[model samples]
Target: MTQATAQTRAFVTGFIPAIALLATVAPAHADLKICNRMSYVVEAAIGIDDKAATATRGWFRIDPAMCRVVLQGPLTADRILLNARALGVYGSSPIPQNGSDTLCIAPNDFVIAAARQCRQGQTAAPFTQITPTQADDGNQVAYLAEDSEYDDEQARLAGIQRLLVIAGYDAAPIDGVDGPKTQAALAAFLKSRGLSPEIVQSPNFFATMIDAVQAPSSTGLTWCNDTPHKVMAAVGTDDGKTVTSRGWYGIDPGKCLHPDVTGQPRQIFSFAEAVDADNRTIRLKDKPLNWGGATQLCTRESKFEINEQGDCGTRGLAATGFAAVDMSGGGKTLRFAMP
Candidate 1:
């Protein structure tokens, strides 16, 4: 099957919007609606505090140019907490989240009550506090748009880097800082696309790029680091017949990297090693600061991409245990998270 076909299947099986079909016109009833004006698919969660209990619910899939009434009926909560994530493998939710309120959310649909110290199987995702304006008709609408995309220089640069990543340019992480890696990636993208490098700063150019990179590609592998320290990752791919191993894709803390390789492979192997700012290997009570499994593949101390996977000694490469990844014969993303 094609990448598009695989993506459609994944969406059908995985994504479930918060609400059903949206009304053509805002309903006469007083309901809280979230309209996503951005170019990518978004998943939203809502937190309501009724004084009796504070509950957070989520995983509402909202597509581009669409709206959904996340909370039906009259807006009862005096203050509503909201959080949203870009519904994709890249996790590129560029919507500016403001406020200090935080909530617990699962990778899937969930409703959790205890906001603090989320129990087993749930991650703490920050939620933005939104004070919706009460309309004359007693309705509320929250528009998630990229109009005022960022309020700071760092955010602007990171936004650009995200677009570059979607457009198949491995610009480093969207770390909200314009570093050498980001600049180099931006320059390469501009040069290859035949666009002026200066246009990278233009809002109009940024909007256009967002539109172009909205749809994510289903091929290749993506590795995300959830640890606090920087991680160096190596991947081995098996196309059913032969296997190849590549190494040294440096990923910053809280960042992800999609190796600059193409095609859908049946099996993927990954091995990650983490280090601090001074390039010192981090160890917790003498345990190795790494993530790997039993699948062994060829690797070297330096950066290298080798075609053959066997005879590591003869080829002057060391054998490393890479965790075999189950792609399920399509696109997949593996996150290297801490315990």
Candidate 2:
């Protein structure tokens, strides 16, 4: 009887045009329906090219053995694009995306047009392409069967890590790779909650972890190193009134680092720079392995704290883009997942 819902908005063809095929069989009352056959709660997004323009909509929550109407009324679009994710307590999407077509999506209800890039306050994510099946009732049906579940070992393990991080355990970035850090965190989590260690060896372990993390945590900013190299991270917080930035916290490979900052803020910003053991930048295609955002902030080379938000050059501090972290529904724990 537990029902959850996520809304995705669609833009009319007057905004952006679709690039795919047009629907050959358009029914007068055609609708788009999604059926969830998985054990976990899944949310879905869809893209449609209604012959004139292409627009997408989604994040509809479909519980196990349930079906949800994604698009109602006449079928207009010929081809469809979809993306689904298993929701976590902290808004961690552990479901493996299965497509290459990128689309722009907002964290909340949105109906954006001309979405080829990640605009301000929006993020670009990949979605799967699916063909709508013409039903006998003239509606479209899309099945989210168990076979579509990303049940790989690495994916399952990463799902557990994401849950652990949300539950106050420092599992870092929920990268689908088994490491010593993940193992230790998992063990500690099992013991602290009185969960039998044997559950770790079962297929239900991932589900168990997800259920346990429903309770919120009180932890602060944490950075997880998901790459092969060591990463140094910086953090910034704005408590609706003032801004404070701090950093140069080094985190080893496959490990997590919790900053000294305590209590939750309204917003958090993060910047990550990957380097070698001797503190040399690692570059791929001449670009340094780093993560940041469009929000310009003041930073320094060494461990430093900057209370002021402006006058970076004049004050002898370097300026960099600190990406805003979406804490997923104002959750207390803010984790900067570095890849």
Candidate lDDT values, in order: 0.62, 0.60
- Expressed as tens digits, the lDDT of each residue in 1-339 for candidate 2 is 001100111111001112221234334467778765444455677777556566766668665445678888866566577766554222212223546777876544566565566566555656667766776767777666443343334445555675676566667765656788888998888887798878877755655665555333444555666687766677788888778887655555665655444456788888877765335566778787788899888976544578888989899878889998877554444333434
Top lDDT prediction, candidate number: 1
Q: Which stretches of candidate 2 lie over 4 Å from their true place?
A: 1-29, 90-95, 135-138, 148-212, 216-339
What is residue 249's positional error in candidate 2, in angstroms? Answer: 19
**Model 1 TM-score on a 0 to 1 scale:** 0.42
Give the per-residue lDDT of model 1 (tens digit) for 276-323: 533345678887688889987997654457787788988777788999
Weakest 10 consecutive residues of candidate 1 by summed lDDT? 13-22
TM-score of each: 0.42, 0.39
Clashes of each: 2, 5
Per-model root-mean-square deviation over C-alphas? 15.4, 15.8
Model 1 lDDT vs. the true structure?
Answer: 0.62
